[model samples]
Target chain A: MIQIKEVVKTYPARDGGSVVTALDGVTLTINRGDIFGIVGYSGAGKSTLLRLINGLEMPTKGEVIVDGKEISRLKERELRQARQKIGMIFQHFHLLWSRTVRENVAFPLEVAGLPKEQIRKRVDQLLERVGLAERADAYPSQLSGGQKQRVGIARALANEPDILLCDEATSALDPETTASILQLLKEIHREMGITLVLITHEMSVVRQICNKMAVMENGRVVETGMVSSIFSQPQQALTKQFVKELQPSTQGDDTSGEVVELPLGDADKLVALAKEHGIRFSVVSGAIAGEQDDCLRVRVDGTEAQMQAVRQVLCGGERAC
Target chain B: MLTGIDWNQVSVALGETLYMVSISTLFTALLGIPLGVMLTVSDRGYFWENMWVQRTLGTIVNIFRAVPFIVLVLFLFPVAEFLVGTTLGPTAATVPLIAGAAPFYARMVETALREIDRGVIEAAQAMGASRLNIIWKVLLPEAMPAIVSGLTVTCVSLISFSAMAGIVGGGGLGDAAFRYGFQSFNDGMLYICGLLLVVMVQLIQMVGDWLVRRLDKR
Candidate 1:
């Protein structure tokens, strides 16, 4: 488990003016055995927050507690000892090109000053776990990108770390590779019972594996909730922007040029208009994208009562009809 | 024509040259790598210091690198004498050779280290590695090829500098040439010593190139 309390990090500019604040009063807690997702755009200080948890960068203010120890205040030796409990993976793979995959995976154990034979056994077990046992002898340059990331995964897990922090772990990967890596991360989380914390701008990555989620903007947590709940009902504007992009329905404006009558409170208008003229509506994506009286047209005439029931069940605001 | 030259003296000069060059190269490398790491660590823009220390170091290294090796030999005779109690033998002569060669090699090492990706450093740290671990494992191993190439350059440069050790009776191949070939203007001796110097330089270059290639091969 990790606890962050009011952490702030600022770096002075070379021009000697106002400083750049990377993290400002960020407080969050990550429980054990949970894949916590932190989503934000570029420059949202997501990477900085992740670095603080791993003890790679100390916070300028407050404390970061990991495994019940205050990591932010730890000395070099103590911090290193504490960091052995935390593993991390990066988007760039970070495999040592000069070393074989086995050596890369073995580096952390070697750095821990473990016995050489133990390191060898651990690396073999890790490489086998990541399904890269056959590629153990191969150098990073000799392997494909996905295989290289597999090696990185094996290396991160070699220490048997209690927590794994992934910083944009799949952003550099292709879609299928990203999917496999995400699945592998999920499996690793479940199988090892390690706490997983990943930060990314990709909503799809969150959709696949995250249980608890936090959306960050301008170095602040704007919204936090469950994955399915956030997908079905997002609170913040940024959350809506991300969730709408994931929706299967909702194309371009349906009623801007082509109108639809969902046969609701517009029943009288539909009859009066039907007497004068017949209106033909085409269905696309089983939902429409249009607005009347500040109410967005979410569905059309396919299911009339369900729309009202959805509206009645979800009475959001005064804008809802 | 060179058949008349003293073969015994030539062999001695060749041996002494080998002694002087290798010793100086080894000494400078020992002194240089630490200095190079310090230079990178203490670089003003990278570290917290002002530009004065960096500028001062740059000035000193450049001053040494810019001075001709023969002048350096003459310049450091007093310091060499103070350090070695006598400046006449190969051991004494090696003082200035190392002094002159270290900054050059240190600069090369600094360049090699500076070229390593900072991302590798961050990744190493993220793995719970200490700064020393990153330096030994990530920085040194990743920069090995460049460091090998730098050593090659330093070896060849030190070999070239060995010719200037003839001053103060330093007694390498340059002494043989000065005593018999260049100063006395013995065409036969001159041709043999000159030919020998050329051969020596060529051999140094070949070994250096081979070592670099061998070490650089992944």
Candidate 2:
């Protein structure tokens, strides 16, 4: 559904000078109906890649092809028309604060100049799909972060887009919310056969929904393959760095004596592996099994919204005021 | 009570004041907003990138913006007279009001329009909204509250400028007070006019604040 070939983008420095290259010859193809994932840390050109797919930022060089159309060559009029078929959600959710949930969802439809009845029908379908039917009348400021993302999800789906591009879509959500959203995307993809693309620093994002994964570092795709392959045996060092969590220590490793610094990415995998091996793995050093260990070292899930809820609950809801 | 203070005359003068200020405010908003949107569309990187177009439009806007209202009134008398077929009446006076302050109002509107989140613009563009639809549906709607507030501010500014119109022989409350208060030495009438202007400002401010809040309920 989406094709990017040798795309390059450069932004000039703040002080009249040389340019900073954001994307350096990124060649990627996301098959239709695939939940494709691009994983990277900050400044890995993930966002730049996302914008190119949506045709928001034209490639400084090369071509971005969506469906049969070359989006980079499409004019503004054609681009907006093209974008209607490709829905996107942001990390921040990007809900218009002035508008209520329903209105925010209605914006794209309104922009597309869709008829009122069709727009309403689509919006209702989307809101129901995102499980935000109850909060349609509420403003974004009144909704929780997860709820806002849900609304954004509904909005993104309003156009019945053939491609859904989520740029850290779940990053601002809690774990529970992220899982729900991931499940929602999976459901939508399953039912409608629409292609979904998500980029994040969180590994679980790929684990849960993405069937295809690409590992990016320094604006280049180091590895791209099936999700199970990348998780089981990552070829690139960076990919391995991301997938280290699922690996088990060789059968005779001495974890019974004391806590050891295991090279695991997330706590869930650590626990699962330890239980599977029937070994007593103590996390005593660094952030191995402490409070911080609970967080994904890779942040592939990109759902950052849980931290606030955790804080609110831990602080007895008083700090939320 | 001052011996010669005519309360009835004060009321009529207030009526005239209301008439003059209302007309000027209407013209400013009517003419200014479209001008501002034009400025936004005409600039480089948007539409028609001709440097001469940008320069000519910028110079026209700046010429009006930089001139004082008092000078613009005097400068525009011929044009105002030609437009309205009268050089010295409330109706004729509006031409100068729109000409003198429309650019300033447009500039304020342009700033307000620009302050809208660029994300909204991108989102609109991504959705296949035409340039006109982007303006009418997204940019204009998003900037509505600010534009309304800007209009209120422009109204208040127009009320102040109306006082300068009195110099062009368009007799309104300002002229009444100037003749009856400053020149005729009617201090009580001057005070009354000052108080009325204050009340008018408060009314405009109250309505403006309420409108901005209503439009941006969040």
Instruction: Give model 1's docking category.
Output: acceptable
Off by over 4 Å in 2: A12-15, A244-321, B40-56
TM-score, cand. 2: 0.81
Per-model TM-score on C-alpha atoms: 0.83, 0.81
Candidate 1, pairs of clashing residues: none
Instruction: Report chain B TM per candidate.
Output: 0.87, 0.91
**Candidate 2, residues B117-145: lDDT per residue as tens digits?**
66666665666667787677766777888
Give lDDT tens digits, candidate 1, residues B1-218. Answer: 66568888888888888888889989898988876776775675442234676677778888988988878888888888899898787877898899898999889888988987666667788777876787788767877777777877787777667776764567878778778887777777777777777887787778867876655524
Whole-model lDDT per candidate: 0.77, 0.75
Can you give the DockQ of every candidate in the order shown? 0.40, 0.38
Candidate 2: TM of chain A?
0.76
| A1-321: candidate 1 lDDT, tens digit per residue | 899899998877767678888888889888887788999888988999999997877899989999988886788788887777788888888777778898999998988999999999999999888899998888887887788788988988888999988989898989999999888998898789899999999999988887778888888878886564465456899988887777757656542332232324444443443344343333221111113122222223324443343334334322233
lDDT of 1 at B109: 86
Q: What is the lDDT of residue A198 in candidate 1?
A: 95
